[model samples]
Target: MEKPKILVTGATGSTGAPSVEMLLQRGHPVRALVHKEDVRSTRLKNLGAEIIVGDMQNMDDVRAAWKGVKRGYFCYPLNPDLLDVTVIFAQAAKEAGAEFIVNMSQKQVAATAKSPATIRHFLSEEVFRWSGIPTTHLRPTFFSEWFLYIAHQIKAGKLQMPFPEDARHAPVAGEDLARTIASILAEPGPHINRAYQLFGPELLSYAEIGEVFSQTLNKDIIYEQNSVQSMADSMGLGGSDHFKDHLANVISDDLFGTPDMNDVIEKITGKGPMTLAEFIDKNRTAFTT
Candidate 1:
């Protein structure tokens, strides 16, 4: 059987780029929608994916990218335009007669949440579901890549926390989530209209995560509980007031987040996801400052 050509949005980002590569590696045709024809797109083009340069918020560009694509993966970044983008993308997918599309969502997203962004996320999920498209929603936990946000702090041998001492979570890697997205696109039959909660292999608090860093990097590490604003500023997540509101609510949401492990990646991709230590070691330079 000929595999359907797949479309991946945000193709230059953390998850979407990798999803494109893995889909191509799995012997499926891939179309990558990037914002520009830059070095990253060039690399993906070198890897044999048809590259389309366009903005996801533009209806015509999305329509053009979806042309002849049967399956798709949609991921937007941390901005205020998610709902608007979702509306455009969903309509484009419907017009394209898409067979299946996977959406990237964060865990603990609820309509009742205080974050407008969280509400937007919930609405975005419904946009696809209401579009009558065969869609799968993946609600993943925090990404281990978030550590890079505070690389300076980590390089100084400290893991900063913005939550209560009791709060814990299993930080997932975006690459692992991308693999799961590829698995679903590679075979979309079983996942139609399904929502999966994705996480890592183990749960740990900020202190424990610091311990892992100390062990893996062989340095004396410490964790300091910080105020949300301080933490957000330190990680550069406090640039805008609207985004800070979302960040604040998300921090509140994480305080009560489910702390457990799941095998979603292993089940879908036939391989377990990497731990924080292993991820740090692999991207050691990023953490080394």
Candidate 2:
């Protein structure tokens, strides 16, 4: 039997990079679709992955990249216009006859639409399903690596959030997300037409996160509750008041409220997902000044 050729879109991003690595390690011929011919693609090329340079928004570019690819792992970078890009790519994938598409989706699809990320992911899943391709939607919860966005604040010894200090989230590790993607691609028959909600081993609050950081870095850390405006300003996220208001609404309602899906991870990958403490410990260097 011949190894399947899997084309991974967004191959330079966190999840895509690891997914590519996992596929190659499992002896699959992997092709990485990157936007620009840059150092990221160079790195993947060094890792023995065939690199195709193109942007998802360009249909001609996407079609060229999809040529002869049997499977796909798709992820959109953080963007408000993701829906438009996804629709284009989904159509291209269908026309190219890709057998399976594993999407990197958000947990927000389960609830209100604050950002277009969740809605776009849902739409892409629908596109794959309607196209008659076997699809696996990997809806992972809040990522523990999101703390990297605010790592400087932790290094400054302050943790500020829009929600309460005790805002709970089931933050999954990105590597676990990659592992699940690899599992689905490696053995597509089992996950055909199914969506797997992936989560970490436990639910943790911001307060608990702070505690973990403090213990890991051996420094005093404090979690402060900031108003939506203040939080947005602190994060330097410039937008209309409506965006801020929607963010506040989602945060208040706790969009991270989801049950543990570690069982699914174990069932699919035959391994337990990484824990929050392990994630913090592994990435503790980012929190140090």
Candidate 3:
């Protein structure tokens, strides 16, 4: 029997890359849609993936990429114009007779007003459902790997934050999320028409994360809370007043929520999610320089 053709958008991103790798390892025929023909595109092409060059915002490009594809992994970064692009992808996917769509979505989407990212993904979900394509929304919690973004502060011996040190979050590893996505894409029907809340095993506070960083780096680190106004001043609102306001509201409420999903990771991917300490230990070198 011939394997189904899978198309992965945002194929160079953290989660998308692993998803592509997993699908390939599982012996599936894959095509990667990238915005530009670059070094990354060349590399994926070498990995037995058909590389298609196209911007997600361009319907013509998206339509071309969807040709002969059966399943699609739609994972794009947060952008203000994402909704417009998503609509085009959905329309194109439907016209091309794609069977399933797996979206990389946020867990806190239910609490806040539609940020550009959430709005676009929410619309994509609706489109897929109405178009009769089996859709699975993977709402993974905060990524433990995102700590690398703040590694500079850890190396400087402090974990500065806008919220209290007790602020808690369930942070999952991107690789784990990718594993779950690949499993579902490999066998489409069971996960179709469902939204899975993916999360790590434990709830950890900012102070706890700091401790993990300290242990992994063999140094002392401490979490420091900053006022909302102070955090806004430091992190700039980025010209989106609505996004800024929504962010402030969510952070004030303590954006790090508890884990609600049970062991869906083990059930879906046949493996436990990676722990924070495991992630820290594996990527400790990133904090060194």
Q: List candidate 2 segments past 4 Å from native.
A: 111-114, 234-236, 240-246, 251-254
Worst 10 residues of 3 by lDDT: 246-255
lDDT of 3 by residue, 113-177 (tens): 34545545566667667778778988776688767666766778877766568777778888898
TM-scores for the candidates: 0.95, 0.91, 0.89
Where does model 1 exceed 4 Å of error? 254-256
Q: Model 1, range 1-289, lDDT digits (tens) per residue?
A: 8878999998988898899999999999999999999999999999999999898889999999999988899999877899999999999999999889999987877777777777788899999989999999998877888887888888988777676555678888889999999999998888999988889887887778888889988898887888778877887776676667776787666524664667878988999999888888988898885
Residues 196-226, candidate 2: write the lDDT tens digits.
7778887777788778777777889878887
Backbone clashes in model 3, listed as residue pairs: none
Clashing pairs for model 2 are none
lDDT of each: 0.86, 0.79, 0.78
- Candidate 3 stretches greater than 4 Å from native: 111-116, 227-246, 249-255, 258-261
Model 2 reaches what TM-score against the true structure?
Answer: 0.91
